[model samples]
Target: MMRKLRNILLTLLLLAIVALTAGSFFLLNHALRPADNKGRDTEGSYAYMFQTYPFLRPWVDSLRRAGALCDTFITSADGTRLHALYARATRPTRRSAVIVHGYKDCAVRMLMIGYLYHHDLGFNILLPDLYGAGQSGGDYIRMGWLDRYDVIRWTCVADELFGPEATIAVHGISMGAATTMMVAGEKQRADVRCFVEDCGYTSVWDEFAKELRAQYGLPEMPLLYTTSMLCRARYGWDFLQASSLAQVAASELPIFFIHGEADDYVPTEMVHPLYEAKRRGGRELWIAPGSAHALSYHDHRAEYTARVRAFVRRYM
Candidate 1:
């Protein structure tokens, strides 16, 4: 009877091991591989934007009529084809902006920001569809770690398009904001002047750990550890190393940090560390009152525009 009990215990342990391994891979896949839309809905997206920001309709209509809204493409170092929407300023100028979209989001979703720079601020704008989102090609999302290299490449493209004398500011929201912070740490062209990141997390590990707790009520121990290892083996990056805090610390360029005071998705407090991480002299922080997540621009359009204009102008 004792021997029989030992055999049953061993069998249960084996089953538990299999279940744990399967569960880890399942979580990794679910997080990394979100639904892809391939940026198919230009008219639909514009309509949604117009409905959300009615003031933008006439301006976007004019841009469309003038043929200022254009598509551009580039191939990444990995040979993945990437797509971006670009528009020249009302007239030729050296001032430009590279606007990045967030996780599971496309360039079209960022047109409001594009309009801010292109129409309101009189600067050329380029909004790229990050890999695996919109029209860009990739197999999985690297959060912001791998996306940073793509954004850096787009800055070079934007500089060339705006001419040699161009001065550029990089702005991103959410995951794209994380990408912007990561890009800040890298060596970039002289034309790249400053960075603006809104509602970005300090690190992938932190964000995922928060989600794991909130959504699954699971602690970040064996599951996060196993999945991070799987991610490193497959995608060449781990959650702990994909850190915006560490990146901002290494950046020499000035940074403007924005966050919604009421934001809970990325959380309002995450911005404090990111703001404090940057070099003291070149950093600015703005916490929009009563706003949530990425809604700062939508909620306070005029103020957001004015602040961004003032900030970018100082550098560009």
Candidate 2:
């Protein structure tokens, strides 16, 4: 009888371990992978996006009609073929800007900033689709971890298209913003000039931990640990190892940090610490009133554009 009891206990323990591992795998996969749209994989939920701002679609169409939008593509370090839409100005100067969009967002969705820089400000703009989003080739989103390297590659595209004399600057919003910070820390050329990051979280681990708790009502201990392990094994990058906070601290790049006061998605508290880390670089911070997440530009376009114009003009 005692032997039978011991055998049953061992079986149950094995089952429990299997359950835990399977649960963690499912959680991470669901979180990182984009949703299926018909047969195609979408960039993830933009449910709140269209309802929040419906004008984005027509605005993109308008830009296309005016001969400002041009298709561009590049091969990533990992051999992923990425896509972008280059915005040309009236004049053919080497001055250029690379505008990166947020999580699940394509370059066309960034028409607001693209128009401000390309058409209005006259900086030849190139907006690239981040890996696993839009036309870019990837199965899962790197959450700005591996993307930092991809943005650097986009700088190469800028050089080839706009030539070596091109004065280049990169600007990113949300996840793209996080990519900018990560790139600032990476080995890069001086010709790339400066960066503008808006509403980006400090690190992938921090963002995922918050979302895991808020959305799933779960803690970030064993589950996050397991997720990180799975990510490292499958994607060749660990979420915990991808820290913009650590990156920006060691970077010499001049950064323009912008955040919305009302942003609860990435949370308003994040940018404060991030700005503090890079303060010695003469980093500029803007906390827009009544703005949420990536809404700072939408809420304060004139002020936002002016700040961007001033920063790039002075730095770039």
Best by lDDT: 1
Per-prediction count of colliding residue pairs? 0, 0
Could you give candidate 1's per-residue lDDT for residues 237-315 as a string of tens digits? 9999999999999999999999999998899999999988897439999999999999999999999999999999999
TM-score of every candidate: 0.95, 0.89
Cα distance off (Å), candidate 2, residue 197 = 0.6
Positional deviation of residue 28's Cα in model 2 after best superposition, in angstroms: 1.6
TM-score of candidate 2 against the unseen true structure: 0.89
Worst window of 10 by summed lDDT in candidate 2: 37-46
Q: After superposition, how far is residue 288 of candidate 1 from its true place, in Å?
A: 0.6
Query: Global CA lDDT of candidate 1, please?
Result: 0.90
